[model samples]
Target: MRYVISFIWAFMLTQMVNFVLNSLGGGSPYMFWSGVALAVIITATIAIFDVMLKHPDEENEAQHNH
Candidate 1:
């Protein structure tokens, strides 16, 4: 559920940036690549933060179980 929300948030953010760039006369290829890059960056940042906020005990337990 968190990941799903993150993805949707990233998509919306990318679209907003793409819209602004397009209005400024950016090319289609530039718009597409920029949007993709933004989405990747946003998703990765959210995932990293989520992991950082997770409990250390839970992480250790999961690792030990595996």
Candidate 2:
């Protein structure tokens, strides 16, 4: 489902962040975990925004109100 896909994307993003940091000589043992935490925060925020913004009945209400 969407949750699974989100997790996959988060992990991949974490990997890429770690790789980039390492290339720039900024890598640390905790950097990967930090990236993961950041990814989770961002993903959760997006998910919440999606839920709040995607109301199927909103369009109907807008049509009636005008």
Candidate 3:
């Protein structure tokens, strides 16, 4: 579910950038591949951050520290 959302968000972001580029007469010939690459990178980055930041024992650790 999160993956799907992340892909959609990344793809739409790429589309918006492409739209801007096209309007500026600087569009890429590899829009589809570029979008895919951006989506993969964004999704992997989100996943990595989620794993690194979301610990189930965070509250316990905080309590122990206090």
Q: Per-candidate RMSD vs. true structure?
A: 3.9, 5.6, 5.4
Question: Estimated TM-score per prediction?
Answer: 0.60, 0.63, 0.66
| Per-residue accuracy of model 1 over 1-66 as CA lDDT, tens digit each | 888788788988898879877878855454566777788788989999988899999999999999
| Number of the top-ranking candidate, with lDDT as the measure | 1
Task: Kindly report which residue stretches of model 2 are placed more than 4 angstroms away from their true locations once superposed.
Answer: 26-30, 58-66
Off by over 4 Å in 3: 25-30, 58-66
Q: Lowest summed-lDDT stretch of 10 residues in model 2?
A: 26-35
TM-score of 2: 0.63
CA-lDDT, candidates in order: 0.82, 0.77, 0.79
Regarding lDDT, does 2 or 3 come out ahead? Answer: 3
Give residue 63's error in model 1 in angstroms.
Answer: 11
Best-to-worst lDDT order: 1, 3, 2
Q: Model 2 clash pairs? A: none
Whole-model lDDT, model 1: 0.82
Per-residue CA lDDT of model 3 for 1-66, tens digit only, reads: 988898899988987876687668865463567667877898899998987898779868977999
Point out the worst 10-residue segment of candidate 3 by lDDT. Answer: 26-35
Tell me the lDDT of model 1 at 26: 52
